[model samples]
Target: MPATAGERPLTPAGRRVLEVASALFYERGIGQVGMELIAAEAGVTKKTVYDRFGSKEALVLAYLRARDERWRAFLDERLAAAPSPRERVLATFDALGEWLRAESARGCSMVNAVAEVPAPDHPVHRVAAEQKSWLRGLYADLIVQAGHGDAGGLADRLALLHEGAVVMFSVGAMADAPEIARDTAAALLP
Candidate 1:
């Protein structure tokens, strides 16, 4: 009988593969990690992995999709906790700074993948761009809703700081990137 949609595997073996893939991608980057290494790490044969994800690109996309969902969820959670629209607008940078400080966190994986993928027509690049634009629009809307007279200006400024902080922290800049980001965010907030 053929396997069901969700019934790939439930034993320890399945978890091991995902755990290894996650760590490898997080550490060495997706472009550098290969299926052979993944299989070795998972104690499974290459055929098994092929059976699972079908292709390296598929695995990469799956990783990115999962990352995107988690990021959206985290931002939604933070917005829920924010007391006002102004706070919601500023939370983007504050949350970004906090996320960057994680020991295991390497900068945005989607951004990294886009940089490497290099094809504007690629689905991953399209998804990444959409995710970024969505966040920017979210901040802009929050700023407008907060009655800030210059909502577009505020959104543009915060977006620059947001992208700058990520790039700075990713490149091993000063240890105070997050603090600087928060301060900048406070200034942008109404």
Candidate 2:
């Protein structure tokens, strides 16, 4: 059983379960972490975990949602502080770089989750897809605001650059990937 859209808010105990499970899922892989471990680490019983989240799959969805929300808030803050649309676009990558260094040196959490969870129809997959869509939309909107023509096309290119930098940075193939991406973006902007 999974949580519905109208599901009631998480109880304090449920929140604890999410907190513990999110850390574990991000630190470990989704497939690697079991509900039992999450329950144990959360200081709750297995039944409580199931009772709160309904299922392991639901818990995974909750974890991804929590991560995505945090990321959006972080990126939004950085973008808000930028003086120009172009700077806002670049600030996104800057935020990503900061996030990579501070939180997830391993890689993008959504990407990691996508790699681990192969089922395309899974709720986790939808969450991952939603994150990517949101990012591309943000880039498109910013590019248009920056007075760039063919905003959609440029947005796609920028999104690729952004994702490439994350992959390169995660694999240690490019120490300056974020800066490089920003430089490439500056050239791409009209």
Candidate 3:
């Protein structure tokens, strides 16, 4: 019988494969990395990699999912320490800044993956879109909690600023994009 959805658990070796793939995929563009490279670096055979993830596309989706999970955890941790809803919203930028500077100075993994993936219907592309939408929703929820009217509009503006900052930072046009974004977000908050 075929396995049901979500039935497969990641074994230790599979987790290692994902960890290596996540790092390689982030450091190098997705297109630059291949299953063989991932397998070699992960100390697993190409067959093992395929047996674990089923396909390269599946592995890419797993990598993005893992990255997204870590990102959300990081943002939540930062937001949790804020004393106010406004600070919580601003803290999201702070969290992003730290993440970009320390973990991924190159740019957003999702955005980068989207650029490499040729098809809109690819699992990685869907995951990337969902990640952005999740961030926008988080911003909107915080804005509402902070007593802001037109939370959706505010969220859209803030999300745009966030995306702009990431692009600028990635292109070396702005080293302090996150801080700048935070300040601009403050002004947007009524």
Per-residue error for 105 in candidate 3, Å, reads 1.0
Model 2 residue runs over 4 Å out of place are 1-6
Which stretches in model 3 have alpha-carbon errors above 4 Å?
A: 1-7
Per-candidate alpha-carbon RMSD to the true structure = 4.0, 2.0, 2.6
TM-score of each: 0.81, 0.95, 0.95
Candidate 3 per-residue lDDT, tens place, 1-190, comes to 1111354888888888989988999898778999999999999999989998888878888888888898888888999999999999999899979988888788888988988987888777888889999989999999999999898999999999999899898889999999999999999887
Q: Model 1, range 46-122, lDDT digits (tens) per residue?
A: 88766776677766766666667767787788788889887776676666766777632567777888887898998
User: How would you encode candidate 2's per-residue C-alpha lDDT over 56-152 as one tens digit per residue?
Assistant: 8888888888888888899989999999988999999899889888887888889999899888987778888888998899999999899888999
Candidate numbers, best lDDT first, in rank order: 2, 3, 1
Model 1 residue runs over 4 Å out of place are 1-19, 103-105
**Local error of candidate 3 at 138, Å?**
0.4
Model 3, C-alpha of 124: deviation from truth (Å):
1.9
CA shift of 40, model 1, Å: 2.2
Clash number for every model? Answer: 0, 0, 0
lDDT score at residue 169, model 1, on the 0-100 scale: 84
Clash list (residue pairs), candidate 2: none
